[model samples]
Target: MPVPRNSKTTGSKQLRPGKAGAVENARPEKEESCQAKRSPSSPQGAPKKRSAFGDLTNAHKNQAGLRKKDATKAGPRKAQKGTAALGVLKNNEINLKKATRKTPPDEASAEPKLVPKNDPVLEEPAPVQAPAIEDIDKEQLGDAYASAEYAKEIFNYMKEREEKFLLPNYMEKQYDISRDMRAILVDWMVEVQENFELNHETLYLAVKLVDHYLVEVVSMRDKLQLIGSTAILIASKFEERCPPCVDDFLYICDDAYKREELIAMEMSILRTLKFDINIPIPYRFLRRFAKLLPLPWSQCAHASMETLTLARFICEMTLPEYDYVQESASKLAASCLLLALKMKSLGGWSPTLEYYSGYSSHELHPLVKRLNFLLTYQHDDKLKAVRTKYSHRVFFEVAKSAPMDMLKLEVALKS
Candidate 1:
């Protein structure tokens, strides 16, 4: 049937089956087109067109490249971890190789090198050797005394102890005693010592006790004799094997002190000195050095005895002189021995003497000259007890020896 041109039913009547299917498809296409137009109103629609400048911008290009790079990197992450571990191992291998490589000789020679060869520039130093026991014993004995390996040790020990008992200055100031009065006391003590036949060590120690006691205590002149007597009494007991009885001391002092007074002074001195009575004296050192004198025994026995007597006289003379309190016993001994050698026309000071005495002749010259002056110049007749003691024949009459001339002493010293 023919359809009317403007009627929808007529148009439907003119449609074939194929045409009808096409019409239905056409309706869906129109619906889709309407939906596409509505989608532009939403935010998630098709991209807007870019400007010319935006297409040339580097930020978008860089972002695109980064995205490509991140995509590529994502696939190799596990392999990249293995490769990083390989690189660290390679670095460790290189460090070990460097550490194990031997240094070249040219580089080693740049530093100080110890070589066993005898080349003067590279020779090693020799090791030090300790002194032999025999050498030490010889040195300790000083070629004179009995061989005592520990003599040097003993001397050093005594030297350390000497500092403790060093007599202080102003010793006489603490007492009513003058230097002259002390000298008189020492002279009388010497006489008493001889009368009692006491050892010379006892006499020296007694003087030390008196001096040390006087330094700590004040006393009247009347009590000075008592103090001296008590000192002698105490020293005798300590240094003597068979000390005299108390009655003997009283008899020597002509009954000047009773037994009780003697005992009291002894206790007072011991208290003041704290019972430390062992003190070094010049007499001991003098005797020790005198034994070292190289005398010509072939000529006569009197030669050795005379030299020792002169040296002893000089040492005893120093004891009464208060100015010599500071002089060490060893030094005084050396000086007196040297002067005795010179006075007797024996050989002058030598290296052997220096080694034993521990002092050089140059160091001993001044002391030697002072001793000569002491012998030659009569300063005090009253202080001549030491001289008178030696003037007798029993003491070798060393005090009767010819006076030493200054010119002769000067010549001897220069040589």
Candidate 2:
């Protein structure tokens, strides 16, 4: 059995019935203090002790927050994949743009830029066509030694070079030396060629050097032999494979000039000529014309060689003659060949000769006539070195061959 007591006197302060009911429905104060003590983020002082009820209460609240965040993250799977793919594509596009900015375009693979129609660079000039000439070197095309492919071009270039080196009547410009002295010097140079066994080109170029040097400088008669010997030395160096030494030229000059004098003269001659001693010679032109003849008349090959020798003899005769210094090597060679052909009774200047020599029979008439006159009146004994050289059996005695008659030579030239 339980005893009942009055509410106001139950060993405590009494509250009205409504107030006590409100207190019974409210949260406990101890629970609120425990939560505040566990939380340092609270406005109260530093946390003291953790109560078990406080731990359980915080765990329940954390679980509710986590569930809300999980629901937000549960988006469509396709949308997430699409966003990632779009971001990758944007990065790739940016990288490609950077690469394009760094690398230059390849020339061979790139398109050619279009040139404006009115540009002067686009307006190409027409090529100047060379004249049509006979193909004389066609047979020698297989002979690499012949240089057949560039023969025409080579000769054409030589002809063009002739105009640049035109010699004037420089004899009148000198005071001490005369044309006759010049002739005597040339005669001696021929003897040097024979003695040294030097090439005929060396002799010709030596003579040319003397004449060219005489044109620019005045020399006394005493030093004439020195000048001639030095000229030979210079030409030998230019044209010979095994040119004689400076001592050899001094010995050849009969020790008349000192070694230093000859060397000084050589330097002076080269300086006066500007070191351009590659003057075209008649021998080269004559040989080229001779080649053209044998092709047309292969049967007369032996006779042609003799005739070439005769032509060379005639050409050599004019080297000492001051009157022919102004003559271009090509034209002089052509006239000499014409005279030889006339003397041999070979067909007068054919189309092949005319094309290669660049001289028609009529155009060469005056020079040919003069060349015949030169052979006709060969009475100069002092200048007989060329004649004596060609008269040998080794040269086929072409010098002993008789000259063509005057009237017959005229007829040949006219034809």
The prediction achieving the highest TM-score against the true structure is 2
What's each prediction's TM-score? 0.64, 0.66
| Clashes, model 1 | 0
Q: Point out the worst 10-residue segment of candidate 1 by lDDT.
A: 18-27
Q: Count the backbone clashes (under 3 Å) in each candidate.
A: 0, 0
Error of model 1, residue 131, in angstroms: 13
Model 1, residue pairs in steric clash: none
Best by lDDT: 2
lDDT of 1 by residue, 136-156 (tens): 244323322232545556555
